[model samples]
Target: MSKRDYYEVLGVSRTASDEELKKAYRRCAMKHHPDRNAGDATSEAAFKECKEAYEVLSDASKRRMYDQHGHAAFEHGMGGGAGGGAGYADMGDIFGDMFGNIFGGGGRGPRRGADIGYVMELSLEEAVRGVEKQIEIPTLDECDSCDGSGSADGKLETCGTCNGRGQVRFQRGIFSMQQGCPHCGGRGQTIENPCGKCHGQGRVEDTKSLQVKIPAGVDNGDRIRLTGEGEAGPAGSPPGDLYVEVRVREHEIFQREGDDLHCEVPIRLTQAALGAAIRVPTLGGEVELKIPAETQAGKVFRLRDKGVQSVRSRRPGDLYCRVVMETPVNLTSEQRELLQQLEATFTGEDARRHSPRSSTFMDGVKGFWDRMTSS
Candidate 1:
């Protein structure tokens, strides 16, 4: 009988992507595998058909040829065979690509260690000016007893299960796949005398103190990386990196936003009206700020180059000072009489000149009430 279409055999669309094709092939191969359904010739044939279909569809050049000329592209030696693609006949690689992790496929090299993170909280002044801090971290380090060889005697023997190949082959119907040896854990060897210090892990858990220098202008959530400072790898493999995360603590005087700083400065009512020079605190130091005459409460003053210098651009930002006018609380009889006489000068029309904002607000309220009454 004529061969079935590759896409039809895999139950995938003609325009299926490589990932979709692999998934469809995996499903079909698993469902119709003869090992799963022994003594069933129909299922065995279906498995072969799906296997051939996958071999052709998974290859780029063969897939293109099949798309253009169909099965005739491979028939009568138009091509080598259905399994003619590069390493298509390698069942170990094919099945390992599909189910290697689940079945414990063996790997050649030593695995890298896991990374770690540490959070460092700094004050606003420290973050802006840069500071060096010492930190203690609990992590895995290479054991000194066995020199990371995992064997106390520094000797290892070949695995009996896989015979030093690290992988064991198993027959599934007519085909077979290779899996990692369970006896040696895919290391191809076994320790004769395990290390007493690390207990054959090659690394031990220990607390390490490290001095970290924090850069200036590093904001909260910024991370600094230290190479090879994380957990040590198994069997003397490479170590991972350590990440130091920055967190700025809340300040009593100033609030930071990016490179700029903001602070509220309280001034007396007389200072706001009459204008005066006062000392304002900045990241650098205290600076003289002149309050303009007739300045209102909540007015903002900008001091150039008085904020934080950015770590990235190294440019300083402006400091913003919000003024808050303070009202007098306590007064003596003579002081109260002097204030009453001063207030008496600004009455009726003079009140509009002295307190224009209050007069305009009162006028708006009166207009609103009159409109409401008329309506």
Candidate 2:
């Protein structure tokens, strides 16, 4: 039979990270566990399918091959060798080595719980100053009723199917396939009396509320890890961690580049021509910016230590204020006449001295036209 895509089997995106893949597998395994579904054959098949998918996707080399060549990469001597003969990992081995105890009766013992990821969005101000937030995540928590035993009577019996091996092997056309026991759900044990709250599974769905303290100067894409704050693992297994990823929202006034802050400061044409001491807004507060006489548009002024203090580096950065010259609008008749009189006076040497860039551009254009005409 043709196999489904590994990412599709695990119910995750193709770009899923290792942590995300683990979390997806954890959910799939718990949902289709034999203990929970008992006699359901469909869930058993799904459990095995997901297990096979995870085995390939979790391995870095195998996943790379699978991504590049699909299932052909692992086919018999397709790339170099049989994908399953030596390279393909069995379900028992997956639970035994990498997971280390996810299957209850395995020699490796139970696997640690899956890690969780959360993105926290903050405004520019909140990110710069730091903030405390209480977040609630829906996750699997240890059942309070059964104490993670999944049994009301607290009694368990060895599974008759695999005989506590947690896995069973079978022969397929010239090849052998090993998978977790369907009857016992790979736990190698059966619950005599299932817990009312969590069915046969040791964990229950619940919301976990936690207070997270964000350190100051945390930038976008920064992550804060909270130990043992993820989903609950099987009994006796250690829990995973929670990674809170920071996403800073766009600021209205300022744009941050590393530790430096940049902003546009608009000024009137008069201010640019005749110098003025103008107050510009900064993150800390407003500061006076001196615009020299005959200053051109797009002039940048750097203020030391006015940007941000990065969490990684103790040294503060500078804030650059780019000046934008604004032209006068909605001119009055008297003001227009006064400007015309000033324009009439700006001729010959005066125009060249005052409008040096404009004079140079005009001279360049005149020379280009002269060359074209001469040619």
Candidate 3:
């Protein structure tokens, strides 16, 4: 019987992408696998057929040859297969060549090192105005003994098991499979005598001191990146970066919102009732604030340009100071007598003129009492 078309056997169109072809082949292979369909010869045969179809159609050069000249391209040693026949061995070699690279095999070259992060705590003052700090970090550095070669005396030899191919192939029932060589660990080369310093790992753990410059106006959770400061990768790979994360500490007296500073200043009751000039603390130093007469408690006073200057802008923020009037306690006997006399003098005057709120409250109380008596 004549063979079926490879694309038809894999159930994919001629224009199928590589990913789509792989998905279709994986689905068909899993569905009709001989291991899954035990005692079913037809399903096992179909599985092998699907594997064969995928082996040819998944390759660009093989698929082109099969499309133009059919299977005859491989009949007379014309194509790159043993005896010019599309056998399982040839198929396994092709699959291994392509999929091995995808799966981190066949000496897939050096990989970049992993990036690391460190949380740096900063005071509110330091965060507002940038500061420089030195920190110590523990990381992996390239071994200096053999120059990261993992070989003593800087000597290496080809793997004997895989003949320097980094992989080994074996025949199964109706298919062939390729796997990484067990002896060489897929490196294709082996150290005759391993380095004593890194123990053949090609990297060592060491602590490094780094100076980090934090920019002003950086808020909490901000990240500063230092290029090529992270751990070194294996042997020939490139080093990674180091990331510094900022965490601002809480202030004792001030609360910051964006670029502004807010604080509460306590004032005596007399300072609120009779005007006075009070001293207020700012980032620049102490400044005098004038409180007007009859100023109520919980009043906010804004001091312009007394807050923080943003890193990105020339204009500075304002400082808001909220006044909290404090009541006197533990009064002396003479002070108590003076307060009593003041209260008596306030009652003798017209209550409406002296205390408008008290006068209005007393009038309401009198009206309620008159209504109750009449009822």
The TM-score ranking, best first, is 2, 1, 3
Question: What does candidate 2's lDDT look like per residue over 78-197, in tens digits?
Answer: 221112344333543444354333322233234566688899999988888899999999888888898887888889888665566555543323434444444554567778888877
Candidate 1, residues 1-375, lDDT tens digits: the string is 898899999888999998889779868977986547878989979987886787678755457657977886555222222123344337755675675544334354344666788999999989999999999998888999988778899998987666676555654444444544434545778888988777676887779899999999999999999999998876677888999999999999999989999999999888998999999988777889999899999999999889899999999988999999888878889988988998889988988999989999999999999999999
By lDDT, is 2 or 3 better?
2
Q: CA lDDT of each candidate?
A: 0.79, 0.77, 0.74
- Give every collision pair in model 2: 101-109, 101-110, 101-111, 102-111
Q: What is the lDDT for 325 in model 2?
A: 83
Q: Mark the regions of model 3 whose C-alpha exceeds 4 Å error after superposition.
A: 1-108, 156-192, 312-315, 344-375
Put down candidate 3 lDDT per residue, 1-375, tens digits, no spaces: 787887888888989997778779878977986557878988978887886677567655456656876765434212222222345656776666665544323543334555778999999889888999999998878889978778877887987766676555544344444444444544667788878776565777779899999988777788999999988865535788999999999898888887899999999877887889999999888999999998878999999988878766846889999999887899999998987887787755564676776778988999999999999
How well does each candidate superpose onto the true structure, as a TM-score?
0.68, 0.71, 0.58
Q: How close to the true structure is residue 347 of candidate 1, measured as C-alpha lDDT?
A: 84
TM-score of 1: 0.68
* Model 2 TM: 0.71
Number of backbone collisions per candidate, in order?
Answer: 0, 4, 0
